[model samples]
Target chain A: MKVKIKSNAFLIAVSAVILGLLAGGLLMMSIGSNPFEGFYYLFRGGLMNMERIGNTISTAITLMLVGLSVAFAFKTGLFNIGAAGQMLVGGLCATLVAHYVFIPRPFYLVVIIFCAFLGGALWGVIPGILKAKFNVHEVVATIMMNWIAYWSIYYFVPAYLKGPSLETESKSIAIGQTLRSPWLTGIFGGGYINLGIFVAIAAVFVIKYVLDKTTLGFELKAVGSNRFCAEYAGIKVNRNVVISMMIAGGLAGLAGMAYYTGYSRNIQIGVMPSMGFDGIAVALLGASNPIGVLFSALFFGMLQSGKGFMNAMTEVPPEIADTIIATIIYFTATSVLFSRFWDSVGRRKRDKAQQKSDQDESKEEVSHE
Target chain B: MNNTTTKQSLFTSPLGIAIYIVVGLVLLAVMATNHLIGMILPYAIAYTIPLLMTALGGLYSERSGVTNLGLEGLMLVGYFASALTINLTEQTLQASALPLGLLAGVLAGALFSMLHAFASINLKADQVISGTAINMLASALTVYLARTIAGSGNVRIMLGIVRRDIPGLSKIPGIGTLFFTQSYWSTWVALIVWGASWFLLYKTSFGLRLRACGEHPSAVASAGVNVYGMRYFGVGMSGALAGLGGSIILITYSGEFNGTVAGLGFLSIAALIFGQWKPLGILGATFFFGTATTIANVSQVIPQLGVIPPVIFKVFPYVVTLLALIVFSKRSAAPKAVGEAF
Candidate 1:
């Protein structure tokens, strides 16, 4: 009854990953493919060449930022499902800047980055305001916001940002206007490598410092842990909610910029980025921790980058990776099942240690007598 | 405060909103000079039926205290199931294939919802997270299976319901022209289901207990009602209705299950909220959205609507939903214990 074992989140997360992989393996077997062979090609596909590795890293950058957005809002106990909307807004802003805003090279990048973040923040703040002021459910509000963003882009892109002949996408920015650099591109063997890598890495460090070292992080976490308790502690709960959503939105905006300007050349109309949804899985698998998110995003990035090669070699279909990721999400969602099983194991260990200590004490008494 | 002024607006009241919705729609009908609302009524009804059924599905689960974000996934499952059934049977069964396909969809949805029910009810998992998982799983699995079976990710059916006017009902004057003429039979089926659902949820003792489970589970439990069983029923109903909704889409206008219900599931959630969780409200709200959507779709081809940007019509419903959220925020009719992991 007195078992004081802490439920280890790390172990729980790892087990879920293993179970998810096993389920994916089972699915492969059901489909008449050898799971071992499927995995072999899958791993090789991601790391087969310098260019492929660069592609993988580029994919990871967008994922990491989106994951961070979800994780940040998650910490404040707000579900920022509108990351997709924020991404669209951010991508639109970055694309517009790249098209018209000519400035000194170094300053141009800063303006684009800031503009993207600001745009995303604008997209995110509405639901936050609705939740804070009117008590609207963020989920429904965000879903509505997503479609609004979707239709807005569907109209806005063709009318204002259309390329000379193409009606569905924005005019491609020149290499000078984009996030690409000659050195990075050379090192990556001219893959989609860009300055976004540095941005993602810098973001990792900044988020880590904020979460571990700052009062704002503490307040956000406090609100997440218990909203009324945080209010009792004299924290302004509503203000923190809005701030958290804004920052989360800003991060997702950065992800959009990373994708549109750094990864791809231009924004495509009528497509809501799937990374916004995938980021939820990344955040869940990482247990909403920044470092954990970075690693998981990298892992997902590998699966996405390798998918085509795996598909060609094994004919197992690209959706196999999605199936695995989805299964992982399901397992994480049922984490309550894992928590109970681990706690019982933890309790048994504590029982053995206590028993051994009691026997040693008895023997010492006997010697004293 | 702006809130106070907004409160004084006529549309804030439910009756006012309903009247405004009808009047506003009538204005659109009147303005489209030389156009027959009858010519457009069938398409509008087609769009409204799916949303109506799905939102009704949502109505069940939410009133029983489970926030079902997975209705989209459930609908997809039904969509796939019906498509597979029809694709297999269409050659042999011919006209008979449609009803069997619909049955398959309903059954598949109910069975699939057990995953959600087990997670939320027995495992006591977070309902929203579990629902999200359901969505992810459905999307990947349906497409994967479709790719395997169809050799392509899309499943197509050659057969669809033929639109016709009702014999006696079409003879009536103004009302018949709008409601009965050039209609798919599924429209009446949907209306019947709506009427039945209203009775079941509001009048029956089973309905009372199920609703009470959402409001106060412990109180219901003390009254000797098995709360878990009631919730299971609620979720099951949602799954079945959503499946019906999805199947209707396939057998009517779509004639193919290419997956991706284009976010109709979430839109249905919006309609449910805008409808204020009542059957009548849902009917009105979905119809309004259906009208808005139909206008957006057909307006691109029509000359007069081209003057106003199609995007305006396309984005109208979603924007109005946000406004409705703001107006309805104070007296939200959301189930008292909805989304709580009880």
Candidate 2:
């Protein structure tokens, strides 16, 4: 009732965020903690210093790319649940290039991009093919691909890229070999800030342009809305499905590059990368728009980066941030209730206007008589 | 035509294929090492029980027209509940603590699943997103709550259900060594549940109505059946069984609530698909995955399996599932109205 503006994706997202915050506050209260104190520390933690801001941005880079991947696939109505696997494969490729490629820095970026994209695309294409050619559900196929990639990385990291003493993670790359540049490091004052930020920003614009302007994007959307209609309209629906997944995989692959090569500088075994799923939330919050995904990823990145500081200062657990994000996604999924409410309000206004106009016409007729 | 159809069905059926794969793998293991089958049987069964229970829970939900991707999260709720209960009560209740903990797990899981039911069924939300929310919320909330109680976000119990042999059954030669020896009581409970589930699903009028709701909710609605009520029951059963599965894992094997079920819930959903939505199919699928996982874990210790890369065994279940999906794509046995909001 209080909402004056017409409900749109942005307002819906804002509403969900507010509800999520309240839910998180309720959780804090249930634990006998001050919600205000918890939130104060949470925001302060993410924006306390230049270094933390840099960390938040770097975190957002990975999340943004993964979000783009999910958002892109969602445009074509495919759920890419295998982003974690794609990220791992992409990270492995980047790690391999970082370790052994021994190329000049000028051309290294190109090589890394190609290798990472190829790796991720290979992983994505299997499920894409399954979905497009065989009618197998992408969710299940991607899930299988995710586990396969997980096990492969679990075996590969230890067997081939083990750190000097640690058998679980790959050896750290030199800063020069990684995505870090000296000037960016100096500006950030010791954070994981790197060229990945630029890449992420570029990806946001590119994905937006592709979705907004390209014929391919139109075809993909067409197939997504109604495959039979798209097919009848002379669009290759199957090709679009495969291509959409390919591009999505490539984006997630870049996320792996941003994370492993740019931020962490190493690959680990047995972890499925929670960013993969968080990206789904990011896509939903963004309403499957590339630009929207960027902002949502940044918001989530702030939550993830700030949680630790909040935990250190308050009695609240770091998991409260995740709890809040989960709650937001829940509210977003159930936003149909909000839509229904909006429709009711609109209907009441229309009815009132109709009655007022009818009363005016009757009064005018009486004056004329 | 009937004989030819039977032959073709035997060769192509998911059950037949799963059986062949298991038997073939067992034979290969036996040929390579004498003691391998006997040694791995107990571990395999232990692993299979959790997956079997979870997948069976999935069977109920999907058959009733709800695509439950939140099985993993529900399993975690049960895992946390059981661990918390057992840890809190082990000193006072002693032996009875285990049963209470399991009951707590089942109750918690069923209770948690109501949220998913409300969102997906009532609100007509996208089932996948709603299920994913359930997964994310349960995971984060459980860990957040667990930190308050356990101090480190993990709940561990000192008392686990110890493995024991059935006195009479253990003496039955080869079958004894494979099935009855060194088994946890939880295994028997899960098997009994599976048997009961099979009967409840196939032999009862209630089960037929539930299955009918999945196939055609409108048709069932015309027959004066409550589609929503049946779906709620289906989802509730899934939650209860998945919780029991989570509890069994804590009591028998894991002995801790570690804020995650390690994707076993997703694996069980894959098993449900692999099994073609039947009780027998699920048994085969879970058993197959369990054996593959056990082999992957123990391959390093076993001389015969050590020659092959552990990665092969680790990736086998997923790869096989993908292949099965491809093979069955033409005529899928999925519930028609599954994932649809009725």
| i-RMSD per candidate, Å | 5.5, 5.8
For model 1, the stretches where C-alpha displacement exceeds 4 angstroms are A1-7, A353-369, B1-34
Q: DockQ each candidate and list the results.
A: 0.52, 0.58
TM-score of 1: 0.94
Error of 1 at B52 (Å): 0.8
Estimate the overall C-alpha local distance difference test score of candidate 2. Answer: 0.88
Query: Per-model C-alpha lDDT, please?
Result: 0.86, 0.88
Question: What is the overall TM-score of model 2 with all chains considered together?
Answer: 0.95
**Per-prediction CA RMSD (Å):** 3.7, 3.3
| Top TM-score prediction, candidate number | 2
Q: What tens digits encode model 1's per-residue C-alpha lDDT throughout B1-342?
A: 133443455355674486568557655754666454766677889999999999999999999988898998899999999999999999999989998998998888888888898888888777877788888888888888888777779999999998898999988998888887888887888899999999999999988998888888889999999989989999999999899999999999899998688888888988898888889989988998887788789887777677878888888888788777776765677788887656
| Ten contiguous residues minimizing lDDT sum, candidate 2 chain A | A1-10
